[model samples]
Target: MVASRSQVADVAANAFRRSCLMARISTKEELRRIIAEPRPATRVKILDSLDEQSIEFLKRCPFALVGTTSADGTVEVSPKGDEPGFIRVEDPKTLLIPERVGNNLAFGLNNILDTGEIGIIALVPATGETLRISGTAEIHDDPELVASLSSLGKPALLATRVRIKHCYFHCARSIVRAKLWDPKAWPAPGRISFGKIIAPRIGESEAVAAQIDANVEGAYTTRLWQNT
Candidate 1:
């Protein structure tokens, strides 16, 4: 005898329910064994001071993510980029990074002002290695420093001076897993057009997307020539 569509659906659902009920249930200890494991301390040596290796890595890095926390406990991470070697190492413990044109929200800078504690992860795309630095940051608008970073007569808006506390070389596990530097693994440019994705959420039109794209391209171009 053939069953109706509703009857067939009910029969399939009952089979699924029985199968689920027959499956082995996990005890708390079994669950803990699967999920909880103590992390072994990484035995890599920490640099007592920023050495030539660290400085060279910082110089070649074109991008860094700055992490900061506010006194009230808000956290922010901001992306900073410029030409290669844009970050200057004044000394073993001191580094300077120029602040260029941004939206002026200053979320990361404000966090620095409130807490003084900051973390930085610098990445060199060509090589899969990354450097991590934890330190205190001071914001400066000194004309001399700003002028030194300016190019084609455009002055830097600000400069951040960081006093290094701990500097370490991070393993490439994350990069290797993500295939970050693999050209073949990159997402296609048109997969999700920036305009289509952002316009509605931002209440902006395609013009806004065009403007943002143009600004980013222009900034990157100008940054290459700036300080030349």
Candidate 2:
């Protein structure tokens, strides 16, 4: 007699459930015993009181990763970058970041508007060190602020101003392992334009693909990195 398909599936499911149960620790005490001891907090220096060094680090950082969470608890981390010193450190507890043209999804910005809680990690490539700042963010379209940041002739849409809660320097272990700053270790693959990648997925014809390729390439070479 041969086992039916449903019987085979049921047997497999039961085995998986049994395996999961066996893998789980029986109690909180068991979990605590199995886990490693927590690290001491002595190494972490609080940023509630910032000094000139922390302020200077924020000012010199050209790129940052902005993390936000929505009311429904959906998390989003997005990269924001521009010419050096794009993020203006208004004071020890405040920072201003310009919002440039993107896909307009505004997922990160929208999350900030809803929850206000934000986390930022600033990276200075040459130094291989990073700084993390966490706090609240507000979207601002102030005319004076926009005008000041747009000195390079590009128009600003909005600026994200953050009220920092805590700031700290992250270790360089990950960067060292990845060899991120070593150009010799970089992978050189065939260059593909963003238009080429999206055209097929979006069902665009050959003519439309060429048009998009030109448009996207022009915008980047002309406006986005013009200052650099």
Candidate 3:
């Protein structure tokens, strides 16, 4: 007997992406069964655009993670950070994010160029709450605008203007569980070095590690303030 069309589609949808992670929660029923439903208050938090509270929250956030996707399905989450209020909220429905200097992977920016879909979560220091913003992104190359949002005498090459569709404050549960701001909870010092990380790739010896570390610090001191 042939399976019905719905059953066939269900079978196709349930296919696992990786064999090792095959114990997948493929169906909505499977997902929901393990997680409790959200309260009505949680549902009501989503907003069509930024409101006064959200605007203030954004003003306090000096760091944010932006998620974007390429047309080919590659996903990236890039961090954009500077002074607080670096991300300009031009109006209730508009947001301007300064694109600063970096490693030049440009994953998030390139994805924005490709598909325009963007999701952002703005965070303040030692704060558990985060502001989530989702919308389409449009790149702006006006030098004056870039300069206006500049930091430490350096200007962005461009800004990504987000036309807000949904904005909300994400709850603090995850942050709380992680004890993000607790100095006591932080891992002990002697953290891994970037020099050690790149040494293997660069085929460098212990003597070169110090040179690499110096180069990294010099780059941060010099190029960090250069025009993006």
TM-score per candidate, chains pooled: 0.70, 0.80, 0.83
Off by over 4 Å in 2: 2-38, 41-43, 189-193, 225-228
The candidate maximizing TM-score is: 3
- Could you tell which candidate, 1 or 2, scores higher by TM-score? 2
Give candidate 1 misplaced runs (Cα > 4 Å): 1-44, 151-153, 190-228
Q: What is the lDDT of candidate 1?
A: 0.82
Please provide, for model 1 over 171-209, each residue's C-alpha lDDT reduced to its tens digit, 9 standing for 90 to 100. 898999999989999888753355556666899988887
lDDT of 3 by residue, 34-127 (tens): 9978899888999999999999988888999999999999889998889999889999999999988777788888899899999999999998
In candidate 3 the C-alpha lDDT for residue 89 amounts to 94
lDDT of 2 by residue, 90-170 (tens): 888888889888767899999998999999888987667788889999999998887777736875678899998888877
Alpha carbon lDDT of each predicted model:
0.82, 0.82, 0.87
User: Clashing residue pairs in candidate 3, if any?
Assistant: none
Query: Can you tell me which runs of candidate 3 are displaced by over 4 Å?
Result: 1-22, 189-192
Model 2 quality (TM-score): 0.80
lDDT of 2 at 97: 85
